[model samples]
Target: MTAAVFGHDGPWTEEEYLALGETQQRVELFDGSLHVTPAPTPRHQRISRKLGNVLEAAAEAVRLELLEAVNVRLRPGRVPIPDLVITEQVDLDELIIEADAVRLVCEIISPSNAATDKVLKMHYYAAAGIEWYLLVEQETLTMHLYQRQGAHYVERSVTKAGAALELTEPVRATIRPEELLG
Candidate 1:
């Protein structure tokens, strides 16, 4: 309930982490450690919603599903709530979606979490064997797409505000960064 409850000396177990239940903040578990982040800004939410709508249409066409801010358990002791995830149809009643079911994960990168989204999460997602990663920059409205190769991910494409990004894999969708804001 309070910060003090999460300040113990030992590493947190997956059971213990999940037992905390949902809070207003975003909480993630990585290698027995918990990382709590503040809720996203309004601008970030706008981008997520618009982009999700686009992806949802594409996913439905391909029989895939697009989920927003869901718990994706990459592996034991590793769970991160991706901004948007395109996954194979999953049981609606399940509390968590496993890594194998995920096709692509997206994150809206704001100034406050630039390093975490661009670097830390990128590595973890790839390591979990998720095929694709999408990052949307909040300030410039730039979008970066990455594909996994071996143990890491390589940049597939980058689309700026005025440009449209054409995605061929996981699902087919054309997106323009500027359009996400409006």
Candidate 2:
């Protein structure tokens, strides 16, 4: 919490990271280091909001829950704030949400951070036992849905701007990728 360099070497803990308080920038923990990401762009936020809305109705019908841009604590040194997290309902009084409760995690890829969203976070989510992960590309309005298979994730579907994606894994829903843009 006290002023210190973020992304420091070796042995960082979640308690120390959480004490930093509310910050304008988004921060995530991986491999005992902190990774700071700037707040999402307006377009990014819009896409995230739209996706959450569509997923919300589907989740409601099934009695599941959806949360946007929430912190998911996988372990002591591995908390990642995903763009949109879909999970079973939990007590609002809890301070942290565990990874096991998360059924799906979605990331709307920013141009500058595509690798992290597409590659790194995919690995993290699968390793954490999340059954579904969605990657939305901003420029093309393409959404890639992955389903966890064994210890890895396999691409289940890819929907472009005009197409509707039908998902049956983490939840059952039909989503048009372009709808996320406007």
Candidate 3:
């Protein structure tokens, strides 16, 4: 599609946003606005792959699925593609995973999108009633875990490099922040 089809005039509709289809960048919708981000660095992908491996086993043990970079529809006109999600099994053929099915949403914070991942997405995820939120800091490999309490998220745990992050609510797992680098 041409740039004209995207229309730079008004806030984007869900239909318009989805019609963008797949691009080389990461595109998300929030309150009818489209936020486009460039593809992550190779280091980001490496950390994501390693951490997903660690979480996948824990998720599978409880019959949940671990997905990476999936479209999660928090609501109409609000869809943020989280870096990782551990969720109840849904139809893989579907393009979007509803918010309620998600048990945990994880985002790896790079210097470029730190605020969006740590603050903006945190608010949206908690508002959507997602039970768990995990944040990983790229440079230091620090991990923060939060659980929803009422309309917001409460900080549950923080694990730095060389430490173990033990989680029990969404699934049972122990992760070391440093291990995610390799």
Q: In lDDT terms, which candidate is top?
A: 1
Better structure of 2 and 3 per lDDT: 3
Tell me how far the alpha carbon of residue 167 in candidate 3 is from the true structure, in angstroms, after superposition.
1.2
Candidate 1 vs candidate 2: the TM-score winner is 1
Task: Write out the backbone clash pairs for model 2.
Answer: none
Compute each candidate's TM-score over C-alphas.
Answer: 0.96, 0.93, 0.96
**Clashes in predicted model 3:** 0
Q: Identify the runs in model 3 with alpha carbons over 4 angstroms from their true place.
A: 1-6
Enumerate residue pairs that collide in model 3. none
Clashes of 2: 0
Residue lDDT tens for model 2, 81-170: 999888899776665789989999999999988999988999988988899989999889899999999778999889997789998756
Q: How well does candidate 2 score on lDDT at residue 78?
A: 91
Per-residue CA lDDT of model 3 for 93-167, tens digit only, reads: 888999999999999998999999988999999999999999999999999999999989999899999789998
